[model samples]
Target chain A: MNVMYFAWVRERIGVPQETVETEAATVNDLIAELKTREDRYAAAFADISALRVALDQELSDFDAPLAGVREVAFFPPMTGG
Target chain B: MQVRVQSEPFDAGAELNGFAQGRTDIGAVVSFTGVVRDTDGTLQEMLIEHYPGMTTSAITKIVEEAVSRWTLADALVIHRHGPLKPGEPIMMVATAAAHRAAAFAAADFLMDYLKSRAPFWKKEITDQGADWVAAKDEDEDALNRW
Candidate 1:
């Protein structure tokens, strides 16, 4: 699966994009897997409270299932304007 | 018809006029322009940075979502990404609809979503140093109030 980050989320995560192979079934499960990666990933996932998740470009909740999803994006609440 | 994430400043009047070109069905056009403000009660420059492709795609999604929820005839969003002086145009959103209500609502919704949901990050250059503008709780609350 491909994961993307934006804004300050990308700054903290160090990389803009990454490909991960996981057995996670839900967005929450994916976060759990990411948190186990390293300190940076843990710090990024440490505060999911301020984060928003989008599955395949559509906004979704953290608990949303990721089954069959090809992409997952995590970022801070948007600040575009 | 156009969505841009660029470093150069844009003219809202020209852009809006261009968007409304040759369209008689658009009875009402609503637009919102965001400008750079001098934060910290001091006159300082603002630097806006964004991921090029990601920023454009994210803003396009927000505009599309607004169109999905409103009866808009046309829409345009142009956001500038780079260093900007105070009072310079930072972003612009224009929406056209047969009725003023739909145009106004859709334009406002697009701005609200863009402010809270876009990939652009701002850094305030102050006398002290450059500091990335942290996401504010009030900004998020503004979205939740919708």
Candidate 2:
């Protein structure tokens, strides 16, 4: 699966884009997998409380299933105006 | 008919006039311009940063959704990224409709969605230090209530 990051989320994680191999079934499961990679990934996701996720460009909840999703993007909550 | 995400500031009146030109059916033109403000009530500067490709697509989606929900004749949205100073324009949304109500509502809806759903991030450089403005839950809740 392909994962993308944006803004400071990219900076913190040290990469803008990455292809991940996972057996995760949900967005939360994917997060768990990324958190296991390194300290940067762990810290970037340490406060998932402040993060938001989008599956295939549609805003989704953390618990949303990613069973058939092809892309997952993680970023901070939107501040655009 | 145009949606732009750039680093240059925009002129609301000029853009509105340009969009309204040669249009006989556009009776109402409504626009909203968002400006940077000093956090302390004093004149402080602000800086905005955003993802390149994602910002444009995100805002374009918001405009498309608004147009589908309303009977708008035209809509223009321009959002500036990179660094910005105090009182400088950060974003603008202009909507044209047959009546003022639809134009006004569409413009407001665009702004609401932009604040809560767009992909831009802002960093404020204060006397203390540089701080990235976190997305507020209140902003999200406001969108939810709509």
Candidate 3:
């Protein structure tokens, strides 16, 4: 799966996107998996409440299933206009 | 309906003039332009970042819904990404209908959705430092009115 980060999440994680081979069943599981890899990941995922997730380019919830999902994006709330 | 997500600047006047031009059936046209605002005057530029694959699709879906819900003759949304200086046009939405109510309501709805639902983020670069603009509760609350 391809994992992407945007805004402050991208800055905190120090990279925009990456391909991760994981057996996680949901977005939350994937975040848990990423947090163990590095301190940056832990810091970025520190507060799930402040984050938003997108599954395959659609706005989704953190508990969304990852089955058949190709991309998962994490970012702060959108501030567009 | 048309949704354009681009990096380059656009001519809002020309686009507005061209939209629904010479359409006798459409009597009302409502357009709204969002500009990069420097409220406290400590800003340098606003850097807009977006999800390339999702930006157009998300906005198109919103526009489609607006059209379906109203008697719209045409609708257009143009949003820019990348660095934009203060006073520059950031985005615009135009809606045309046979009556003023539909056009006005749809344009207002589009702006509300664009502010919160679009997959775009704004970062303000100020004289002191750069920071990501936080999404305001009022902006999210605005969606409930629709």
Candidate 4:
């Protein structure tokens, strides 16, 4: 699976995208897995309320199932237009 | 319908003039352009970032909903990403319809949705420092009015 980050989250994570192999069942589960891997991930995921998730390019909830999902993106709330 | 996402600067008036061209059935055309404003006169640049794969699809869906809700002859959306000066344009929305009401309403709806729903982020660079612009509750609340 490919995981991505954007904006300040990307700056914190230090990478835009990465391919990860995981057994996570949901977006939150994946975040938990990543948090254990590095301090940067822990810091970025510290406040989930300040972040938003997208499963396969569509806006989705943290509890959204990751079954058959190829891409997951994490970022802060959009300030577009 | 046309949707363009680019970092290059664009002329909004030219884009508006070229939109829905030579269409006899269209009686009204409405457009809205978003410009970076330096409220405190201390801003240097605005940096915009967006998701690559999702942007086109998200915007297409928004415009399609507008087309279905209103009788539009055509529509155009252009959004830019990357660092931009305070006076530069951030984005533009244009809609053409048989009636003024439909065109006006559709354009307004497009702006409201684009403000909150698009997968784009903004950072303001001022004389003091650069900071990410937080999404406003008012932007989210604006969508409810549609």
Candidate 5:
């Protein structure tokens, strides 16, 4: 699976993207797994409410099942236009 | 419909002139262009970041909705990313319809969705420092009008 970050989340995580092999079933579970890897991931995932998630490039919920998901993205609320 | 996500600056006037050109079926065309604001005059540059694949797809969905609801003949959306200076055009939305109301309403609707739905983030680089532009609550609320 490919995991991605953007904006301040990317800055906090210190990387834009990575390939992860996980047994997680949901977006939240993936975050929990990444949080245990380093302090940076922990800091980035500290405030889940301040973040938004996208599964396979579409906006999705953190509790969304990741059964066939290939990509996951996390970022702050968009400030486009 | 046409959607472009690029870092290159575009001439909004030229784009508007070319949109829905030579189309006898279209009677009205409306456009809105967003420009970078240097409110305090301390800004150095505005850096825009976007999710490459999602940005285009999200905006395309918004345009599709606008077209379906408004009876539009054509629509165009162009958004810029990367570093930009104050007063530079950030994005533009144009819609063509058989009537003025449809054209106007669709353009407005596109702006509203693009403000909060598209996966783009902006960072303001000022003389003092850099800060991410937070999404306003009103932007999210704007979608409720639809």
Candidate 6:
């Protein structure tokens, strides 16, 4: 699966997107898996409250199932307009 | 309905003039243009980032919802990304309807949704540094009013 990060999360993670292989069932589970990889991932995933998730380009909750999701995105709350 | 997510600047006036033009059915056309506002004098530019694949789809979905909710003859949304100077246009929403009230309401509805619900992110660049603009609770609250 492809995991994308945007805005400050991208800055914090030091990358825009990456490919990861995981058995995680939900968005939160994926975040938890990534958190154990490195300090940067841990720091970025430390506070999930400040982030928003999108599953396959649609806004989704942290606990959303990722059964068939090809891509997942994490970012701060949108400040568009 | 039309939704455009581009990196280049757009002419709001020309867009409004062309949208639903010469349509006798549409009597009222309401437009709202959002400009890059610099809160302090030290601001240099505003950088907008968006999900390429999701931006158009999300905007189109919003426009479709507006069309279904109102008696809209037509609707248009143009949002620009990349770096934009102060006072430059960021986005514009236009709605056309048989009466002023419907047009006005639909335009307002689109603006509110675009403000917080859209996938775009805004970063303010100033002499100090660049920082991502945080979403405000009021912006989220504004959506609930409709």
Which number leads on DockQ? 5
Q: lDDT at A60 for candidate 3? A: 97
Q: Please provide, for model 4 over A9-80, each residue's C-alpha lDDT reduced to its tens digit, 9 standing for 90 to 100.
A: 999999999999999999999999999999999999999999999999999999999999999999999998
Q: Candidate 2 — which residues are off by over 4 angstroms? A: A65-70, B41-45
- Candidate 6 docking quality: incorrect, acceptable, medium or high: high
Name the docking class for model 3: high
- Compared with the true structure, what per-residue lDDT tens digits does model 4 show for residues B1-146? 99999999999999998999999998999999999999999999999999989998999999999999997999999999999998899999999999999999999999999988889999999999989999888988999998
Q: How high is the lDDT of residue A31 in model 5?
A: 94
TM-score of 1: 0.80
TM-score of each: 0.80, 0.87, 0.98, 0.97, 0.98, 0.98
Q: lDDT at A51 for candidate 5?
A: 97
At residue B72, candidate 6 shows an lDDT of 96
lDDT of 5 by residue, B1-146 (tens): 99999999999999999999999998899999999999999999999999997999999999999999998999999999999999999999999999999999999999999999999999999999999999999999999999
lDDT for each residue of candidate 1 in B102-126, tens digit (9 for 90 to 100): 9988887887788877777787887
Per-residue lDDT of candidate 2, residues B24-143 (tens digit): 997898889998988696445566766564677888888988887887888999999888888899989899999999998899889889998887878888777777788877887777
* Candidates 2 and 4 compared by TM-score, better number: 4
C-alpha positional error of residue A24 in candidate 4 after TM-score superposition, expressed in Å: 0.2
Candidate 4 residue pairs in clash (backbone atoms < 3 Å):
none
The per-residue C-alpha lDDT of model 5 at residue B90 equals: 99
> What RMSD does each model have against the real structure?
3.0, 2.4, 0.8, 1.0, 0.7, 0.8
DockQ of every candidate = 0.48, 0.66, 0.90, 0.90, 0.96, 0.92
**Tens digit per residue, CA lDDT, model 3, A1-81:** 999999999999999999999999999999999999999999999999999999999999988899999999999999878
- Could you tell me which residue pairs clash in candidate 2? none
The worst-scoring run of ten residues by lDDT in candidate 4 chain B lies at B111-120
RMSD of 3: 0.8
Chain A, model 5: TM: 0.98
Task: Residues B39-103, candidate 6: write the lDDT tens digits.
Answer: 78888999999999789998999999999899799999999999999999999999999999999
Which interface RMSD values do the candidates have, in the order shown?
Answer: 2.4, 1.7, 0.5, 0.7, 0.4, 0.6
